[model samples]
Target: MSHTPAPSRYDRQPYRRSGRSGLLLPTLSLGLWHNFGDVDRHDTAREMLLGAFDRGITHFDLANNYGPPPGSAEVTMGRVLREDLAAYRDELIISTKAGYRMNPGPYGEWGSRKYLLASLDASLKRLGLPYVDIFYSHRPDPDTPLEETMGALDQAVRSGRALYVGLSNYSAAQTREASAILRRLGTPCVIHQPRYSMLDRHVEGGLLDVLAEEGIGCIAFSPLAQGLLTEKYLASIPADSRAAKGGFLKPTDITPGRLAALRGLKELADARGQTLAQLALSWVLRQPVMTSILVGASRLAQIDDALGIIAAAPLNDAELAAIDAALALENATT
Candidate 1:
C-alpha cells in the first residue's frame, strides 16, 4: 500500500521547544518500547508508524533493548523508516537510548564510556541512520563514575552520532550533577525522560523542579503507566494484557485498592468526556516543563486514543481537586 503523509499534519498538532533548545518536538511522541518487535507483524507496525506521522506525531522514541528478544524493535523501525518514512526523515525527531544490557559481557551495558559509545554505534547500525536526533544514557550507572557517563553522552553529540543528549531514570540530584557536567563539556543536556503518570508521581517530588531550573526538556515515558491508567484494566485484566503476561506490570500490581481508584478515575473521565488514559496524559502535559508525553500503542486505535489527548482541554481546578481527592482515597485503601 502507498502511504502519503497527511498534508495538514503540521496544522493539527502542537509543537513545544525542548527545554531551552531550539528543537521543537511534538506534544505527543510515539514509543517503540512495545508492540514493534519481531514477535509482532511488520505490517501492523508500519501502519502505526505511518498513522502516528499522519496524525502529526513527529517524534518516535526507541531504545537499544526494546524488543522482547532485544534490538528487534529497532530492526523493525529501520524497515519501516526505509519503506515508509524515508522521504520525511528530515521532519522527524528520531531518538534511541543505550545503557541497558544489549549483549552478554562486561562491556554490554551501563554508562561506561566504552559501553555507551559502542551501544550508540550498534543502535545507529540497527536504526539505519547516520545520527539520531537525541541519544540518551537510558539510566544512571551507580557502578560507573558520573563523569564517564556524561562524557560519553557529550562524545555522542560531539562525534556527530547524535544531534543532542538526554538522560533517563535519573533522580533530581543526579540530573543536576549530570546536567552540570554536560554543560561544562560544551554539550548541554537537552532532555530528560522519566516515568510520569497519575500513579507514578516521583518526578513531581523534585525532578520537575530540577529540570525547570536547569532548563532541560522533559518527555515522560510510561505516561499511561503501562496501560494501568487506561480503562482496559478497570474491570479485570484481559488475558492478553501486559499485567497478565507478568513482565514489567505484574498481575499483583493491580490490587483491589488500585481497581477502586481506577473506577473513581473512570467516573471522572466520563464526566470530562475523556478516557482515563487521555486524562492521565493530559494531567502529565499540564506541567509546563513537560515537552511531550511518550506513549506506546499496540494498535491503531490506541494511537488514535492517545492523539486525542492533544485536543482535550486542560483539566480544570475543580477536576484537579477531585482527582487529588480520589487519589487520597486510593492511598488510604492501599
Candidate 2:
C-alpha cells in the first residue's frame, strides 16, 4: 500500500530523552510482540504501522522471538519498511532484541557473544536495515557471564550494527553492573526495558531506582499487562483475548477480586475521561525515570486509545491514592 504520513506527524505527541543519551523517543512506542506475526493478517499489521506513524509514534519495538513462530514480526516490519516507510527511515526509531530462544541448538539463543552477535546479524537481515536504532539483550542469561553479554552489546555499537544498546528483564543489581560495564566500554546502556504496568509494579521495587541512578532510560513493556489493564476483561474475557489463548496471560489469572479491582480502576478512568488502558499507561509514565511506554495493539483503535493518554492529565495524588486503595482492597479480598 502506498503511504503518506501525516504532515504534522511530530506536532502534538511528546518525546522523552532516553536516559542521558541525546536520543529522544516518542512518549509512546509500538511493540510488535503480538499481532504483527505471520499468524496475523498482513493488511492489518501494515495498516497499524502506517496509522501509528501517521499519529506520530516513531518508535517500533520488536524482539527476535516476538512472533508465535519466532522472528516473523521482524519480517513483517521489514516488509512494511520496504514497501511503505523506506523514505522516512531516518524518522523512525526501530529497535529489536536478542537473548531469547529463537531457534534450536545452544548457539541459537541466550547471551553468548556468539548468540548475541549472530542474532543481531540475523535480526538486521530480517529487519532489512543495516542497523537498528537500539539493539537489546532481551534478558539476562543465567549461564552466560554478564561480562560476555555486555561485551556483545558493546560490540554491537562499535561494529555500527546498532546505534545504541539496551538491557531488558534485568534486575536492579544486574542493571547497575551491566550499566557500569557498558559505560566502561563507552556504550553507556541508553535504555532498559522491563515489564511494567499498574497490574505489575515489580520494576518499582528497585529497577527504576537503578536506572535513575545510572542515568539509563526506562521504556516499559507490557504497560497494559498483556491487555489485562484494559476494559476487555472487566466483565468477561473476549474469545480472542490473550488470556483465552492460554499463553503469558491465562483466564485463570483473572479472578473475581482482580476483576473488582479493575472495575474500580475503570471508574477512576471514567471520571478522568480516559479508558482504563489509558489510565494504566499514564500511571506507569508517572515515574520520572520513564522515557516511554511500549504499547502492543491488535487494531488501529487500540493504537488510538493508547495515544489518548498522551493528552490526558497525569494522575494526581488523590487519584493515585484511590488506585492504591482499590488495589489494596483487592489484595485484602483475595
Candidate 3:
C-alpha cells in the first residue's frame, strides 16, 4: 500500500539551520539506534517511521552497528524507505555512521580510511540509498590518524556516497583537530553528535564551545539520559525498560538518590504541565547551539510526547536554578 503523508506535516514543527550550513533540520530527529532491529516488530517500526515524518521529523539517524546484531537497523530502515518513504526521499535527511565493530577483522572497525569507506558502501547497500545526507565517524579511533578518518569523510562527499560529513563521540580536542583537517580538505564539518542530557553534561566541559567556534551544529543523543530523565524509573525499573535490558543503562544505575532527583524533576514538570521527559528535553534545548535532539521511540506516544516539548516555554532563570538544586541534592544524598 502506498503511504500518504499528512499534508500539515510541515506546519507544526520548527527547523533549525545546522551551523554555517544550508541544511535545516527539524528540532526533533528520529534515531534508529534501537527498536528498529530485526528482532523488533516491523509493524511498530514502520508506524514510528511514517508517524515521525508525518509530524515533520525529516531527519533520521542511523549507524553501521546500531542493532543488536549490528547493521540490522539499517536493513529495517531500508525496508521502510523502499515501501513507505520512497516518495518523500527529497524531504528526508537520512544519515548513517561508521566507526564501531561490525565485523571481526583488521579493518572491521575504527576510523581508518579503508574501514570508513567500506562501511559507507555497506551502509548504503543496507539502507538502499545512493548516498546518505550525513555520514559520521561514529567515534574517534585512538589507534588511527585523524587525517585518515577525516580524509575518508571528505572522500565520502567527493565520491558521492554522502552529501555531508560529521563526527560523533569525539572529544573537544579531537573535534577541533578533525574540523581543521576537514576544513583544509574543503569539506567543512557540518554537525557533531554528542551524548548530552541534564544527567550527562560532559559536552559543556568544552565540546559545545569547540562546536560553536568551529561553526558545527550539535544534535544531542540521549537527551533524556537513556530514559533516566523520565518518570519510568522514578519508583522502580520496569521489566520491559531499557535499564532492565542491561546494556548502556543498568538497573544499578538507578540509585535511591537518582530516584529522589527524578521525583523532584517530575514535580517541576507537573507545574509546567509537561512530562518528566519533556522537561529534560526542554532543558537540553536551552542551549543556543543545540540544533536538534535525536530521540528514540519504541511507541508512537513517546514521539508525540517529545514533539509536544517544542511549544513549551523555555526554562527561565529560576527554573534552571531549581533544576541545578535538584541535581545537587542527588550528589548530597548519594
For model 2, the local distance difference test gives 0.92
Clashing pairs in 1: none
- Candidate ranking under lDDT, highest first, comes to 3, 2, 1
Q: How far does residue 73 in candidate 2 sit from its true spot (Å)? A: 0.4
Tens-place lDDT digits, model 2, residues 161-195: 99999999999999999999988988899999999
Note the Cα lDDT for every prediction shown: 0.91, 0.92, 0.93
For candidate 1, the lDDT comes to: 0.91
Model 1: residues with Cα > 4 Å off, grouped in runs: none
lDDT per residue, candidate 1, 75-94, as tens digits? Answer: 99888888788888999999
How does residue 126 of candidate 3 score in lDDT?
A: 96
Q: Which digits, one per residue and each the tens of the lDDT, describe model 3 over residues 1-334? A: 6689999999978999999999899999999999999889999999999999999999999999988679999999999999988988999999999998988989999899999999999999999999999999999999998989999999999999999999999999999999999999999999999999988999999999999999999999999988899888877789999899998999988988888788888899999999999999999999989899999999999999999898899999999999999887677786
> Model 3 TM-score?
0.99
